[model samples]
Target chain A: MIDGYFSLYQTRSVNERKFSNFGKTEIGMQKTGFIPAIPDFTLTPRIDQVGAEERASRFTKRSIKKESKVNGLKLVLNMIDLTTLEGKDTEGKVKQLCYKAMHLHDALPGLPTVAAVCVYPTMVRTAKKALLDSGIKVASVATAFPSGQASKEVKIKDTKYAVDNGADEVDMVISRGKFHAGEYNYVYDEIAEIKEACGEARLKVILETSDLITFDKIRRASDIAMYAGADFIKTATGKVQPPSSMPVALIMLEAIRDFYYKTGRMVGMKPAGGISKAKAALHYLVMVKEVLGEAWLNNHWFRFGASSLANDVLMQIMKEKTGVYQCASYFSVD
Target chain B: MEKEIKKSSLSVSENGIEKKISPKRLEVLKTYKIYIGGQFPRTESGRYYVAVNAAGKQLANVCLSSRKDFRDAVVSARNAFAGWSERAAFNRGQILYRMAEMLEGRKIQFTDELMQQDVPKAKAEKEVNLAIDRLIYYAGWCDKYQQVFSAVNPVATSHFNFSVPEPTGVVSIIAPQEDGLLGLISVVAPVIAGGNTCIVLASGSKPLCAVTFAEVINSSDVPGGVVNILTGKVSELSSWFVSHMDVNATIYCEKDSTVQKMMQDKAALNVKRVIFYDKINWNTDEGQSPYLIMDTQEIKTTWHPIEHIAGSGGGY
Candidate 1:
C-alpha cells in the first residue's frame, strides 16, 4: 500500500529537475551583478486550514512493513539532528550526545549514524572537538533562540560567536513580536543580516509557529525567511508547547514549493521538537516525498531536530530484527 | 402476567387504530473486553469467541487474545514493575485488602457466572467466598513475609552479612483450566502481594468470571498493569508466556505433561523460573500459603563493612 503511493511520485522527479535548473538560474543572476527586487511580503498566499490537515492525516495511514519499514526506519535515523538544548547543558553532556550521534547502538550491526548534533552556542566547541573525525556536523542554536528578544547587534555577534567556534550550521529565531506588530520588513532584514554574519556556515531560520498561532501567518513568515536567504526554515526551537505539528509543516512545505516555482531557488525544511516517535517521523517523510518529491528526502534538504527520536527509531529497527518488544533499560539514556 | 398484558393492550386500543405490543424486553449483555495498561480495549487482531452457558446458550463474546496481546501485556507489566516493587509493603497489603472489599461487594455476580459454567449454586457460593477470603489472607501476609524469609549470617570476619527476598520482576501464569475464579485468584493474589506484576491466561471455557473480576480489580486501589488477565487457549499462548526474555518466572497450574515438557525445554533459553501447581486443589486449605508468594521472589545477599566494637570486638 505504501509502495503504490511512493510510485505515484516517482514520475514527478523529472519535473523536479526542471525546478532545480530554474533555482540555479536565480542564483547565477545574483552573482552576475543583477539583484532581484524585494518581493511584496503582504501578498503571501493564504493556506486552506482544513484541506491541509486532511492531507496530512492521509500520509499517516500508509502501511510500510517488512523490508520497506526497516529501510524507512534507518532513513529516519540518518536524518536526525540529535539535539540537547537545555539550560543545564554541560560540556560532559555535549560530549555524551556527540558520542551517541556517531554510534547509535553498537549491539545492532550495520546501523547508520545521525546527520548532526545540535546544542547551545557555548557547547558547540565541545561538540565540535568530540565529533572531530566523524562525518556528523555540529549545529548550534543562536540569536536568542526560543525568544528573539535581544538587540540586532547582539544577535549578530551571537551568530558570529557560534560560527567562529566551528559550528557548521546556526539555527536562529525570528522576531515574532515585530511580525505581530505589523513590521514584516524588520523580521526580513534581521534574517538577511544573520545570513551574512554566518559567513561560510548555513543559517536555519526558526519561525516558532506556536507563537505565530495561525497558518496564514506561518505561511507569510516562511516566505519572508526564504526571501531573506535562509538556507533552511525550521518549525520550532524545541522549548514551546504544540511544537512541530504535521499540519503546520504541510503549510511550510507548500510555501517552499511555491517559492521554488517562482524564483527557481530551493530552500530546505526542518521540523524540530515534539516529534519523538518513529511512526510520526515516517508520516513526515511521506508528506515530504509527496509534497517536495525525492530531491528533499536526504538530510541535506530535510532534517528532524530531536533528542529522543533516535532511540525510538533504533528500538523499532531492533524489534523488526528480533521479533520481540524492547525495553528502555536496554538502550542508553542519552 | 398474561391478564395484565391483555388489559394494557385493550387500554391502548381506545384510539382509532390498534397497536401490537410485545410483553418481553431483551436485556443488554456486557461486552467482555480485555484490560491492558488500565484501559479496556478489544484484541488488536479483531477476533472473538463465543462463551456459552451449560445449556449451550451464548453468554457473551470473549476476546480471543493472540500472541501480540500477550506481548503488549508483558510490556505494560514490565513498565509497572518498578513503581509496584518500590511501594511500601504495608501499602501493598492495604491495596490487596481493598481488592477483597471490592470483590465482596460483587459476590452475587461472580456466583451467577460460576453457576452458568455448570457449577452447583452451593459450590459457586463457596468459591466466591474462598476467593475473597484468600485475598485477605495474602494481604495479611504481605508485610510479614519478608521478616520470616530474610536471614542474618554468622561470618568469621568483622563484617555484617544478611540476605533478603525481593520481587522477581514480571511473572507469567497459565491459570488453571477447570476452576476459573478460584484458580485465577489462587495464583495472582500471592504473586502480586509479594510486589511482582503478572500476566495471566484465564480458563478458556469459563471466562465470564475472569472479566467481571477484572472490573472489581479496576475499582479497587490496585494499580493497572500489575495484574493483566487474558481469555484464550493455553496451548496456543504457553510458549510465548514461557520464552519471553522479560518474563522472570512462569506458573502452570494444569496437569498436562506434554505442555510441561514444552515449557521446560523452551524456558531453558532464558533460564526462567518455571513452577507447577498441578496437584494442589483450589477448594482445600492447602491452596493458600506463603510458599506461593516465595515462588516468584529472588534472594539477595549483602555484605557491609563495619568497624570493630570498642570492647565486644564484634562478638555480639
Candidate 2:
C-alpha cells in the first residue's frame, strides 16, 4: 500500500506541469499539485455551518431582472440535465423525455437544448439512440445508482454497460457507508476505479450529501472525490429528503472552486433534485457566477439535474415573450 | 369633537383623564387584500383603489387586482379542481354547509360591512340572512343536483348510454355590481356546490363583504382555491377572466353591452362557456336553482358496453 502511494505520487509529479496565474488570486492557497505528498483526509478544513448557511441564503437576494432574468432563465433551461430515474420508466418514456430534451419549447424558437438527459444504466442505449445528433448528451446513473449497495465488480460492470451502450456521461454514487466507517481509502479507490471504467465518458460523482448529513463530512467527501478523478461533483440522488439545499450546494461549489485553484483543472457541479423552479435555478446560477465565475456558467461546467425545471423556465420565457403568465396546463406534461 | 379622527387615530379620554396619546395608538384599519389559494396576498400589481360609500366616506383600501392576480387565482383554481371535483358529492355538500355555518357565525361582521357600504340597517341584515340561506340551499343541492340534471339516454344499442355532469375544471366570474354579499353567494354557491372551483371578482364598488366572505371561507372547511375572491374593477379583469385558457367557464353579472361583447369575443378564443346573470334579482326565487350549478359543469356522455339495465327498476 505504501509503495502504491509512492508510485502514484511519482507518476503524478512527472505528468503535472507548473500551475500558473493563481499566485496573486484571492482566497490564497499556494498548494502545488506536483508535490511528493498527499494531504491527510481526516484534516480537511472544517466549515462554519452557520456562516455557510447565511452566505448561501445571501445568493438568493440578488434580484435578476428583465433582460438578464430572461437570459438567466434561458441559461437555466440550457443547463438542465433532464432526468427520469424511475423503476417503472420504459423505452417509450425515455424516447419522450429525449424528445422533450431536444425540443424544450418549439413554440418559442431559438431556445437551446438542455445539457443532457440523465437516466438509469438500462435505459442508456434507448436514450443515446433517441438523442443522436441532437447535441444533447445521454448520461446514465450506474454503480447501483441511488443506493450504492452493490460490490465493486458489479459497479464497474454497471458503468461499462452504460458506456458500451453509448452513454456520453456516467453518474456514480460513492460508498457513504464505507466513508462513515472511516475507510476513506476504500471510498477513494472505488471512485478512482469508476473514473477509469468511465474511459472517455465524463464522471459525475454523487456525494449524496443528504446521507453525508454534516458540512464537515460533505467537504471531506468533496475533496476525496475531486482528488480521486471526479469530473463533476453532484449534490444528491433526487430520492432523498432535503435533496440538494443551497448550503450543501454552496459547500460543493466552494470545493470545486478550491480544486480548480489548487490543480488548475476545472470540474463541473450539478445540484440535482429539489430544484424544480426557474427562480431557484436562477439563484443557483447567480451563486455559480459569484463563486465559480463566468467560465463555469456554461452547460459544460455547470448543469442542473432536474426534470420539471425545463417547463418552468420555458413558461417564464414565454411570459416574457407574450406578456402573459403561461399556464402549466398549456405545457406538455412529461 | 376631537373624536372625528384623522387617518386612523382617535382622541379618547382614558379613566376620565385627558391623556395625550401617541399617533402610534391609532385604530388599526383592516387591509382588504385579494384571496387566492386560501391566503390573503396583496395584489401582485401593488395598486389599490379607495372603496367609498354612498355618503362618499372612504371605506377602505381594496386591492385593485390586475390581470396577473386573475392569472394566479386561475392557477390556484385549476390546481384545486382535481381534488375538489373528485370529492364525493356528500362531502362537498358538507363543506358548503360548513361555509354557511361560518358565514352565519360572522353574520354581524358581514352585516356591518354591508351597512358601511350605505345599505340600510334592515337591508344589510336581510342581505346577510339571504347570503347564509343561499349557501345552505346550495349545500342541500350539492349531492342532489346531479340526479336532477344527469340523464339515462335511450339508446338503440346494447351499450348503456348515460350523460352525467362533471365539474368544469376552473370557472372565472365577474360577480354582480350590486348586492355585494348576496350576489357573490348566489353565483358562487351554485358553482362550487357543483364541485367546480372558481375565481370571482367581487362587486367593485362594495367589496368589503367579499373580503370578509373570504375570511369566512378561510375559517370554514371549504378548501382553499375552491372560491377565490378578488376585489377589483370588473372592466379591468373580465377580459382576462374569460380569455384565460385554463378557465372552463366565465360568468359575468354586469349589464354593460360593450363589455359583454368583448367578453363573448374573448371567451370564444377557448370556446369557453360565457354566462350572463345580469337579469337575475338575487333576492327573488330566480337567484337559486340547480341550473346555475349546471352553468359551470360539463355534461360527459359515457357509453359503456353492458346489458341495458338502466331505468329497469328506478321509480318502479
- For residues B133-156, could you state the per-residue lDDT of candidate 1 as single tens digits? 999999999999999999998777
* CAPRI quality level assigned to candidate 1 from its DockQ score: acceptable
Candidate 1 backbone collisions, by pair: A23-A264
Q: Name the best candidate (by DockQ).
A: 2
Query: Between which residue pairs do clashes occur in model 2?
Result: none
Off by over 4 Å in 1: A1-39, B1-19, B257-271, B309-316
TM-score of chain A of each: 0.90, 0.89
- Cα lDDT tens digits, model 1, A196-253, are 7887788899999999999889988998888778889999998889777999999899
Per-residue lDDT of candidate 2, residues B1-316 (tens digit): 3333334454556555455557665688999999999999999999999999988899999999999888888878888988898999999999889988998888888889999999999999998998999989999999998999899998766677899999887888888989998999999999999888999999999899999899989988878888899998876777788777778888989889999899898877668899999899999888999999988888999988775455553221
DockQ of each: 0.28, 0.31
- For candidate 2, what is the total of clashing residue pairs? 0
